[model samples]
Target chain A: MAEPILQVRGLSTYFFADEGVVRAVDGASFDLYPGRTLGIVGESGCGKSVTARSILRIVERPGRIVGGEILLRRHSGQVVDLVTLPSDGSAMRQIRGGEIGLVFQEPMSSLSAFHTVGVQLIEAIRLHSPLSKKAARARAIELLALVGIPRPAHRIDAYSFELSGGLRQRVMVALALAAEPHVLIADEPTTALDVTTQAQILELIARLQRERDLAVILITHDMGVIAEMADDVVVMYLGREVEKGPVDAIFHAPRHPYTQSLLRSIPSVLAEPRARLATISGSIPHPLARPAGCPFHPRCPDAMPGRCDADVPVEVSFADNHVTACHLYTEPVA
Target chain B: MTTPVLEVPVLEVRGLRKHFPIRQGLLGRVTGQIRAVDDVSFSIAHGETLSLVGESGCGKTTTSRCILRAIAPTSGKILFRDEHGDAIDVAGLDRKGLRPLRRRMQMIFQDPFSSLNPRMTIAEIIGEPLLVQGMRDTRERETRVADLLRLVRLPAAYLNRFPHAFSGGQRQRIGIARALALNPSLIVADEPVSALDVSVQAQIVNLMLDLQDQLGLTYLFVAHDLSVVKHVSHRVAVMYAGRIVETAPTKQLFTSPKHPYTEALLSAVPVPDPRRRAHRIVLEGDVADPSNPPPGCHFHPRCKYATEQCRTEVPALTEIEPGHAVSCLRAAELSLRGVASGS
Candidate 1:
């Protein structure tokens, strides 16, 4: 297997609020291999999105990546720490979209209504490559067709508002792939779409990933989406990694109590009809009033009294390529 | 899979259609009609939850509203049964006549944050329904409100606090409590738990089920999530383009679906387990517009099995087995896939 394309080590992002410092991401680490999808799964306020934003040095106001090394291997095999790069420097700007493409849930958030879809695609293409307007327009149409939008030449000239939700998402995918980025970061790309449309989007991503050989970082709260799309999974709670494992192990043999309960809590479509769902004991705690020690100790079903609350658990490998930070799994399971 | 099946239905909707008129010109002349909820029909037995599952703009909410008369439907009959086995034509009733029947049918809205009045305390909000139903004594209303708070598993001490004091799940509980205050025989919950987080969503869904068992309440559960519907509803009705394409017992529908659209929708859902990822039958193209739907089957535009006959001939909802109904030209011939083995 090829080496990892991007590496994150000891990444920490904090939001300096008036009340106190909010540790949105605390000492999180992960590696993204080429052509593989790494899913970051968590509920709201879990810092999954913040971690993605931090990699691109695009954390919003009041929130900044305090410490970390975000290493990315370029096409030339040269490694650079993205965290140390200046926010608006030429290097950061090139890596932000030229090397790493971003796809958000809502296309309108990234695409403007004023310009035509073709115009936006051309802008992205021209920014990365030294292509003329006509050449860029041709590339834009080709990208549109690549993303499976029918009659691309005509639809590309149409405004974004004129397109449907599914069509708009396809356009977003076209725009993201316009630069032929090495890595793709999709944050809930299909959450707002219908089931049929969602299937289309997922298939498109998988197809494009193979065609482009892109490493994908998928951030979503839905475990179902994670299981279907991810090769590796990272489970987060209250801004800390609870478990990191292969997709199969994380789904079938989760080590962390929190992950176990979450799998049980969600009502699976394949389950028997009218079956009672197991529920987590409590809601996600207030962000500012996060639980001490293991962060999920208060809600963990199999939490140990003093051990879970005293301090965070050290990482332990429960199986091949599967590690979890839970007090219950101190030693590797045979 | 055997459970208690009620004899009489608490709510029955027949041939219901809600058409919004598209006006043009200065005088607002009607140009065309958007058949939002066209020829929809379903029944929820007493103490049973029947979910109206569909994508957005498929008339799930519109059908629920027609039952509540929130908006006047263009045509159809809404028969709501009371405790005395009387089936009242809710659609044909005048304002004065409908006012009394409103006590028997209460609606739980999707948004908890906007549904409750911020100015009112928890006691006032839940008790307001009792007052509307003609519970005169102030002390009696207070007693009922406290009972409701306890019934919904909320603390009675929270009665004095405003809605802004609570979280999304807590606010939804308040909405449920208010819907239950009138002793309504049928509750119309439109996406009741969609606004809450996943963990909180499970809590609300389980609470709703528990309440159904305790109070013997019938629910017209409308939602887009089929997984949650399978957990909550006894029967599921799949709607698309404002039509009931399939209606069957939850188990029968999930295990062996008859409609191609049903198969596509079930397969599209991302199975939580990676080992169980089945080959999805993705329906191509956007959902048909209600204003100008396809000639015959609304889903013909996207169905892979569509032929010349399917494009021109609309299939009627036919019952193929006990408590199972489907609408498709190839319902009998096509053996569609379902998530039966949890795969």
Candidate 2:
């Protein structure tokens, strides 16, 4: 493995609430190398989005990163700890959009409804670069073209409401690239689009990631998207990493019970016509009232009686790059 | 798989059209009609799931609303036969006459939060249909509401809670329970599981399928999720520019799609396998505005194999197989070249 561009070690984020402190992200860790895409897959309330927000220090009020080390590789070849960096400091602000660009789930909501797509892109460019208004506008147009938006010269001036969902998302990608960031964090960018549009967007993202050598942290519930784009996969459940490995390894042989259950639950077109879909019976446990031992023990079909319900499982190694937190693959099993 | 338990089609729509008058200027005069849903026709068999799928603004929702009579259709024939086997014209029903028709068909809205009244408790929300239909006695209503909640997998104790207390999936379940309160035979679910997580989506789709099996209900399932629609639907209807481009059995539609639009849609779905790489038919260009749709085939502007004939003459839907129908000038000549080439 190459040297990682970003390293998240023992990351834990919590929300201070009236009822109790909610451990929204608990001891999650991953590494992102340059020019590679790492996908974080989970259900809605599994803290995947929260984990992404914590990386940028955009975890809103009531939510705070309790413990962790976020190491980022600087352009000068220096590794800086993002956690220890002062909040709202100049260096951190420079990294927020300048070094690490974020593309939110809904382009319509993230982009200003009132402003034209070009105006927003220009604004982002001006924030990161010392370009004049005209230069920034040209840069914005260039970024739009870079993201595969055809006829950017004409479509750039259109308002958000006027553009299609796919076009708007392309503009969001353009804005993300306006500052020439090394890393892009896309949170369910194609979830709001149709299948045809989604495929186009995914292909665009993959092509751009290669051309720019940009490291990407993609957060999505769609496994298909993860499979198509991600080189490495991280399965998050109830704010913790259940499995992390190469996408091929994880898909071919998921060691964790939670990961297996999730994969089985998905209805695949490749599967037999009459094959019954497997469903993990039970909603994701609320963050406030999470399970004691294994967060997935309550729903695990192959859970050990005392082992899965009595203690937390450590990360057991399957291969050089594969790791899983499941009692089924503990030291005793080996 | 066992033989399909085929039943007579309970609802048939012919040449359905819905046009919203576009108001212009300070005088508020109607300038032109926004042709949201134009000349779309399909039939729903008893206990069968018919999915209407297309991108946003393709008139799938408008078609559903027209069938529900929530918004009156501009012109069409909505022939529905009730449980008594009596044919009724749903489009001609007024507010007073529509009351009885409402008991025969119900609508499950997309957004659970907005569709449900915030002020009403779960019980009140679910029981509203019963109350509106003049179901007397508070005791009987409470029991029926409890049953509905249990049917939707919600605990009976949650009857007193409000919509804000439930998660998106739970809220959608509540919406389903409310739609089923009146024992309607036909349920028009407009993207019921679109807002849910992928994992939650399968659970809801399975639940709907199970409910259909138990109750023998017909569903007009409208959604953009091809995977979910292909899973839950018995027959699939592919819509483009407010018109159905193709209608076929679920398997046939996925494997042997006739229309270029249908072929493009199926090819776009990424197979969830890291080892296998599937070809994606990238549709370039935006969806045309329905108000001023293309002269002939609405999809010609973006179609890869579009010819001069497709640009001049509008193709009429014709049966290519026993039950499969497609609206394409070159249905006989076109071939889907990818994974969905043949059955």
Candidate 3:
């Protein structure tokens, strides 16, 4: 395997609210190799998005990274720990878009409504590189065209609101690629898109990854997407990663009960018509009231009586890089 | 479970059209019309689920809204069968005439978060329909609410709790309980589980199927997720640019679709199995704008097998097989690939 472009270890992000500290992303560890896509799959409130934000050091106020190490291999062949750098400092700012780009779920919310798509693109371009306005505008048009936006010259002048959902997302991709970053973090990029549109966007991302040899972190709640795009998979329940392995291993021989149940629960196109989908027992617990021991113990069908409810499970490794955090594979501690 | 009688449809719609006139200039003159629902027609038998599947702005929701008379259609007949087995023209009904019929048809909204009122208790939310129907006694309403809650598998003990206390899946169940309060024969669920998580969505889908079996209800399920649609629907109508391009039994639609758009849609859905990563037919352009669609077939602009005739002449939806319909000029010649069998 090639060298990993980014390595995240023991990442824990928490939101300090009046009620309690909400562990949005707790001890999520993963490695992102160049030219390979790592999919972070989980349901809503599972903290996949928070993990991505933590990596970029852009987690909003009242929410901060309590513990983590985001190690990024820079273009100069020097590895730097992103966590130690001040989030607003020049070094972190340079790494944000210059080294790693981000595409958010809601394009309309992420984009500036007042500015034209070209204006935003141009600003992003100039911020990373010392370019004149005309040069930046030209690069912006090129970026839009690269992302498969039709008639980039004309569409560039349109406001974000004027564009359709699919086109708006294309512009967002264009903006993400404005700085020509080596890594792309797409947070539920196609969740808001139609199926056909989603196919187009996914294809675009795949093509761009191949072209740039970019390491990609694709976060989504859809297992189908993870199966389709990811080279490796990380399944999170609540805030913690319950399983991580090669995509095929995770899908074909899932270890964690949460991952297995999630795969079985989603209705598949291949499944027989009207077949009853196997469902997980309960909904995700509230962030403040997260269950002790294993986060998925409450919903796990294979949960052991007192073991799964009393003590946290340790990571158990298997062949083919498959790792699962479940009491089923671990010995009971004295 | 009793088999749905195919002879008498619970609700039938014919040539439904909903056009929102685009006004422009100082005088607010009618310049153009967005044909949100254009000449759409389908029928749902008792205890059957017929899903309207499409992208956003494809008019699936508009069709459902028109069927419920929540929004008036510009033209066409919404024939809803009454308890007497008489097909009532809901489109032609006046306010007084529609009041009683409203109890026979109810709508479930997409977003559970906003569909429910935060101020109202679960009991009040579910019993609102009973109260409106002149169930004067609070005790009677309470009992009925408890029964409805049990039907959706929620505990009757949580009746006093507000919507804020429940999770999204629980809230959706509450919404379903409210929709079933009137004991409507037809339920128009507009993207009901699309807002829910995968695990929770399956639970709701199963609940809906179970409820359908138990109550002998007909569902006009509107959703964009083909997987969920396939799970719950007996038949499906594929919509594009305010029109149904194809309609078929769920199994047939998945195994052997006749329409190019349907084939593309089926192929585009990402299969959960990594081993089945087949080539997806990427549609070239965006969905056609309803206000100014193409000259003939709305999907022709992006279709891979589009011919000259497809671009020039409008193709009427024609039945290719029994219960399978397609609206393409070369429907006979085109052997479109559906999702591979054994998915």
Candidate 4:
């Protein structure tokens, strides 16, 4: 494999609320090669979105990236430390939407309802690419077409409200691809969409990745989408990486108890009707009251006596492609 | 199966329609009606679970609301029969006549937190509904409320606390208790578990199933989640553009969905398996506007196998197999997503 376009090491983000300090994203590490789709799958409070946002330095105030290295390789073969770069640096400016684009979950919230989608797309394009209005509009239509929006020419003038959820999402995708970024961060892109629309969007993203060699980071809780689009999977629990591996390995032989429990909890489409789905008992532990030792031990079915209850388990490599942070898997497997 | 709990259907709906007038004038002149629910028809057999599954804005909620008479239907009949075999056409009832029927048919909303009145204590919120129907006397109401709390698996001690004091799953349990306060024969739960965590969702779903068995209650479950719907529903209705495109027994629909829309929906659902690969029938576009649906088949625009016949004529729900009804011109030839074409 070629050198990774982006490398994140030991990234940690936290928020200080009135209650206490909430360790949102703690020590998340991953590498993103061009054209590879990496999936971050976790429940609501797992900090998957925060990790994505931290990469862009969009972590809002009260929340701060206390530690980590975000390294980016420029087109000119320039290696830059993204975290250390000045907020107002010219290079960082070029990279924000130019090199790393984002497609948010809610199009209505991200898109301006009052403005026509044509205007928003054109503006996004112009911000990154120094193009005239007519050229940008043309490019917007082309990009919209790339995302499988039909009748792009006339539909570009339609307001966000006038367009359907799938079309608006396509428009968002067009905006994200405006600069033809090296990496795209899509946070729950299909969670709000219906199943049919979700499938189309996922297929479209995969097709685009193959065609353009765009590094995509898909953050979602849906395991199905991960199986469809992800090359690698990263499972987070209580703001930490509980498991990481190839999609097949993670799905088939999940090492962490949390990952195993999560997989078991989902009602399979192919499962017999009479069989009850294996549900992980108890809710996601609150950020403030996150249990001592392994964050998942409270809900883990195979939690050992002292190992899983006292000390935080270090991420141990189980295979060439798989890594898990569970005490039970600490010993070498026969 | 199990002697068909109530023998008579708890709620029977036929060609229900709800059209919101699109007016544009000081005088509020009616220009055209937005057909939120065009022509929906279904029945909830006694102690049966019938789920209305659809995407957002497909009028599943509207159809459920109309059944509860929370919102009046513009046309068609909603025959709701009580346990004593007393039938009432809810559509024809005025406020005075409908008051008594409210006890027979209760609704459970989507968001448990918002569905519950935050100002009131859990005890008050659950007991108020029963109290409204003249079940006064604080002592008796408290006892009944405590029992209801226990029924949903929440401790009776937590009854004095406000809704905000509990977690999302607990709040939903409280919402369930409040809905069951009237001991309604039929309950319309609109996306009851969608807002919960996945694990929490499973527990709540199991709780609902257990409650059904214990109470011998009928549930009109409405949700977009097909897996949960399949797990809970005895019969399933697939709605598209404010109309039911398909209706069948749960097993039959999952095994051999006849309609293209139903097939597309089922295929779109991601199977949580790494070994099995699914060729999902991805629809080309989003759901069309309910206000102005397509001329003929509302789904034709997005449907892949839509022919000219599908474009010009609206298909009626016809029985293609035993207990299976589908609305599609080409139901005979189409291959469904998850299920085999023939059963």
**By DockQ, who's the top model here?**
3
True contacts kept of each: 0.76, 0.44, 0.76, 0.44
Q: What tens digits encode model 3's per-residue C-alpha lDDT throughout A1-334?
A: 9899999999999999999999999998999999999999999889999999998999998999999799999988899999999999999999998999999999989999999999899999999999999999999988889999989899989999999888999999988888888899999999999999999999999999999999999999999999999999999988999999999999999988899899989898887778788999889899999998898888888988888888989898887778899988985333
lDDT of 4 by residue, A1-334 (tens): 9899999999999999999999999899999889899999998789999999888888897998899999988777787888897666787788888999899999888999889999998988998889999999999899888889889898998999988888888888888989889899999999888878888888888888999999999999888788878888999998999999988999888888889888877755555442356788777878988889999888889988788899999988876679998888777764
> For candidate 3, what is the DockQ-based docking class?
medium
Looking at model 1, residue B311 earns an lDDT score of: 91
Which pairs of residues collide in model 3? none
Write candidate 2's Cα lDDT for B1-343 as tens digits: 2324546578999899999988989999998988899998888878888899998889999999898899999999898888788778898889998877888898887787688899999999999889989998899999999999888899998999999888777888999999999999899999888777666777788888888888887899998877777668888898998999999888888777899988888778777778866767888877878988899898999999899999989999899998899999999988775243212
Q: Count the backbone clashes (under 3 Å) in each candidate.
A: 0, 0, 0, 0
After superposition of all CA atoms, the RMSD between model 1 and the true structure is 1.7
Model 4 segments beyond 4 Å from truth?
A332-334, B1-6, B25-27, B333-337, B340-343
Instruction: Return the top candidate by TM-score.
Output: 3
For TM-score, candidate 3 versus 4, the one ahead is 3
lDDT of 1 by residue, A1-334 (tens): 7999999998999999999889999988999998999999998889999999999899998999999899999766899999889989998898878899999999877789999999999999999999999999999999999999999999989999889899999999888888888999998899888888999999999999998889999999999999999999999988899899899999988888889889998988877777778899777887888887899988877878988888888888764778888878786577
Tell me which of candidates 3 and 4 scores higher on lDDT: 3
True contacts kept of 1: 0.76
- Per-candidate TM vs. native? 0.97, 0.95, 0.98, 0.96
DockQ of each: 0.69, 0.47, 0.72, 0.50
lDDT of 2 at B275: 81
lDDT of 2 by residue, A203-320 (tens): 8888988898999999999888888888999999988899999999989888888888888788666544433568887777778888888999988889888888889888887655
